[model samples]
Target chain A: MAVSDRSASHLGEAVGLSDEQLIEMYRLVALTRALDERMWVLNRAGRIPFVISGQGHEGAQVAITWPLRKQHDWVAPFYRSIATCLTFGMSPRDILTAQYATANDPSSGGRQMPGHYGSREHNLVSVSSPVATQLLHAIGIALAAKVRGTDQVAMTFMGEGSSNQGDVHEGLNFAAIHKLPFVFVVENNGYAISVPSAKELAVEDVASRAGGYGMPGLVVDGSDVLECYRVATEAVDRARSGGGPTLIEAKVTRLTAHSSDDQQTKYRSEEELASEKARDPLPRFRAQLVDAGILTDHVEQRLGADIKAVVDDATQYAESQPDPDPSTAMRWVYAEEWPSEAPPPWGFGTAGGHAEEH
Target chain B: MPAKTFIEAIREGMADEMRHDGSIIVLGEDVGKKGGVFLATDGLWAEFGDDRVIDTPLTESQIIGTSIGAAINGLRPVAEIQFADFIHPAFNQLVSEAARLRYRSNNGYSCPMVVRAPYGGGVHGALYHSQSVEAFFTHVPGLKVVIPSTPYDAKGLLRSSIRDDDPVLFFEHKKMYRSVRGEVPDGEYAVPLGRAAVTRAGTQLTVIGYGLMAHYALEAAERVADDGISAEVIDLRTLRPLDKESVLDSVRKTGKCLVVYEDNRFGGYGAEVAAIVAEEAFDYLDGPVTRMAGPDVPGVLQPRPRGLVHDQPGEDRRRDPD
Candidate 1:
């Protein structure tokens, strides 16, 4: 629990995670990373259509997702939140199946363009391709929770460039004004597509705008899983207690291109990419565990082997799954009819004639 | 029962809904202290206080977007956009967010909200103040578009929209705000969305329209009736969840159709009605469907008297020959 504490602890005390929990977190992160890598491979092979890698974001994602009560609280995640989704109990099979656009994909049933996954059971709203759209949606969900007198809070994830969107500002303003229970997590990986963060805004930190909205802003080392867990826990707790929204800026690194279609070398120099690789969050956390004696080389090797087996099985299962039926494309466009007087028009059923010509 | 103009009926409807449901709130620019630019939300600020009848900043996006959030949060919000032309800034929120929320969420939730704006061109309000944007919203599913031609339907349909579980784009014709008047009952009444009202039944031609164009159609129907031609006038109260049954029934009975709308002829709501008539009741048609609409050219600023003349009938003739 020393890692959960706010005070800084040396690498010695941090490695005391129960062996089981450490292995579980590490395995989940590894599966998420592997799933993303395999997705890129599929994209290259033209087997799958699109891919957005969650590389270098595993630590913060795993840490932030650990404390939240899935199926109770809501998550409005961005496209880059694969690791976060994995930590939130989405099976590796589910992620890979969705990537492969298979029928068994629980999130969207292969209907949505890949990566726009959502599950009502898990309280995760479907992700849209429009950047920063989820910010307002999260605020709206939190506001609904507030009005319904529920203790539930919503967490909205976005990137550094999304901070420049008007919807983001409007969302934060509304959340602050209404004191809605929610948190804004900006996974600042330094670049939005080809544009660098410096070219997007005057402020270096996206969290700095929280003050303008009369909310608390915290900047945390995104590579440090312990720091992420502690900050996210405090923020979620505050929101649940009706202390309003908190803006958390997670300083992570984007180890892969924005998407499989992107080439990071065009925008970032080789030296910068090399430095970022050196600070890769997974290896850093692993080193910390080793230095603390919480994990020995033997245990680490076994954990890796277990993770590989799980990911391999999931990938194979997903690859073998059947693609969705083309006719089912129109299914999720609207909800099924409820018992209301005027139910949604599901299919093309024309109403009987009652027209008058004037 | 009492005679009231379209604007008065709208005001009465908001006041009644506010009195009936504590959760109902009205917010927009100049909607509170100023009683709205068109006075459609008049006198309610005094009764509901500042919280329920709020005057928001001059941000259309926030006005409509916040209303969506508020609506989802159990508050029945009626957001006024001052004029229909100014709604472009908030168009994304309406189309992408509000319209899709219920559909995308699989009906787990709904946005019970109304965006009220005065539309049409007869008032000589020129470019920004007048434009029929209903076509834009009508194309978007999960949104109910309502345009009332009289006081009674305005009051009844506005009430229904407030209680309904879908986002409604309520277009109030600026020209008919005071020009159109009818008896609206004092007691609570709800005119269901998607149901058209037959203002006058005839046999020669089925004249179809809504809002200000409905009034014109009524007038034209009367003139045609004087000439020994029977005209059935149908007021399409809601555009999206269109009263297709009523429309097809009228077109079938009359065997002829004339659709009128104030928006440009190209890709207007009238085009949708024409397509439906051709597809569903084509065999019964006696003549080709005709449409009367505004000019395709962008509105120009006219000097005094010329501007006043633009507000008058026959000033700017319909660009379409039909």
Candidate 2:
């Protein structure tokens, strides 16, 4: 119930979570980290096209979504929302399929770049490459929920860089004016692509801008999983209880460069990179579980082994899956099978005809 | 059945659909209490209340972006961009998000929302309010661009756009909103998109146009008929899927073609029609297809002597191609 500082307690029990829930949270964090590691390898080996690392971000991403009801509450995720998407019922195989852009990839059938995640079955909105677009979408979903009296909270994620987009301001102002049941979280991982926070945000914290939009804003330590869970749960509860929208700035650390193509070393200082290690949430969360006697050396080894095996199986399954059918490349331009008005001559409504400008 | 103005028919279409289906909600600046800037959504707020008829803050992107979200989730939201000139702010939401929702998601999701904006110049709404931007959107695939010429087509196409399972941009001409009128049936009727109607059939040449231009083309066709120049006028109800057959059939019958539009002549929507005719019906064409469009100006005007509405002081009655 308290808005804790960056040095707040990270204990799962301190947040009233059970030992089993703590262990499950740890497993999810480790799995996301391992899968992200595999994606970088796949990118380097010319197997996959790109990689958007979710390394230092695992804890906050995983914990903030702990209270959300899977397939009931809606989520509008950004590209770096691997842990959040996984927490929302996206499997390890689902991540790999999206990474590989295979025929069965639910996010997009090899159409979009890697890290774009969405699943209607899981109540996740489609993740577009453009940042801050999802903020408006979450606001919209929240508006729909409020209108229907669905008692559901809509949550969305963005980065410090994306917070400056015009859409973010518009979405925040709209949600605030309407008092929509929405939660907007900005995962400030120090830098956006290569632009640091200072260059992106003129203010000290991105949360400070929330005042302009008339919403309650707070900052959270992204590495402290339990604290983030407490904060996000309160925000979601507030939204569902007609308290309107809230903005959260999760101060995470980007463990890797922006993507496979970006080189953070070109701009980031060695000292800054060193500082990110101590803020790495995965190892921090792991050590906390160990210090609490919730996980022993044997259990830790088993957990690591289990995550490695799952990542390996997902990678192999996705690698062997067929690429999106080349012949069906231009499908779903207009909601396929909506009963066309008997398309005109020159095969107007056919796959090739309708895609004249596709 | 009674005759109604284009704007009245549009209001009727939305009101009737909202009565039949509760999911349909209207959201935009002045769309609710103010009944829209042009009164297109007049009286919707009183009937549907604030929940169904929402008056949003003055932001086009939020108006459209939220509608896309609401559409994909459950509600059938009808977002209005106060004017066509102001629609540029939400171009990304429409082109990138709504247009690509189904394709980018690989049919995993679809944005079944309608973004209605009054377009074209006629009421002396200079510069910011008088721009025609249909060509800007018609070029984008996965989006249906419709401009109705008559009240009857407006109501039918309104229902079709509401029921269609994809994003539709419905542009109503400001000049024709109150000026144009036609009988709309009291019962149910829906005009399917991607089709065109030949308002006037002739054999000399095919005049292809949509929106207010379609009505002008029909009048021009009738006038030229008295001069022994038989002209066929084709009203392109839907511009994206574009009744290619109707235009081609007319062009093949009449050896010549002329496309008219109110947008900029340099890159007007009529150019696409001209291109399509040249590409497919090249052999059938007796001569090169031509385009009659607005001059390459920043905005459309009522020509000089602005206040002259039907023979004013010192105003020339004769009209020339500007």
* Residues B1-322, model 2: lDDT tens digits: 7998888999999999999998899999988888988898999999999999998888899999999988877999998888899999898998899999898888899989999998877665667877889998998888999999999999999999998888999999887787777999988899988788999999999999899788778878887888999999999999977778788899999999999888888888998889989998999999999998776768755555243211122223231111
Query: On residues A84-129, what C-alpha lDDT tens digit does candidate 1 reach at each position?
Result: 8877767778788878878767666775677877665677776757
Candidate 1 structure quality by residue, lDDT tens digits, B1-322: 7887778899999999999998888978899878998777778898888768877766687777767766755688899998888998888888887887664544445578999998876554677766889999888876779999899999999998888777899998887787777898999998887788899989879989998788778877887677899999999988877877788888999999999887878899999999999888999998899987766755424333243213344334322100
Model 1 chain A lDDT-worst window of ten: A349-358
Cα deviation in Å at residue B121, candidate 2? Answer: 0.6
What DockQ class does candidate 1 belong to?
A: acceptable
Cα lDDT tens digits for candidate 2, A304-357? 788888999999999999998786776788865533333333244445344333
Q: List the residue pairs that clash in candidate 2.
A: none
Candidate 2 chain A: 10-residue stretch with minimal lDDT: A1-10
Per-residue error for A159 in candidate 2, Å, reads 0.5
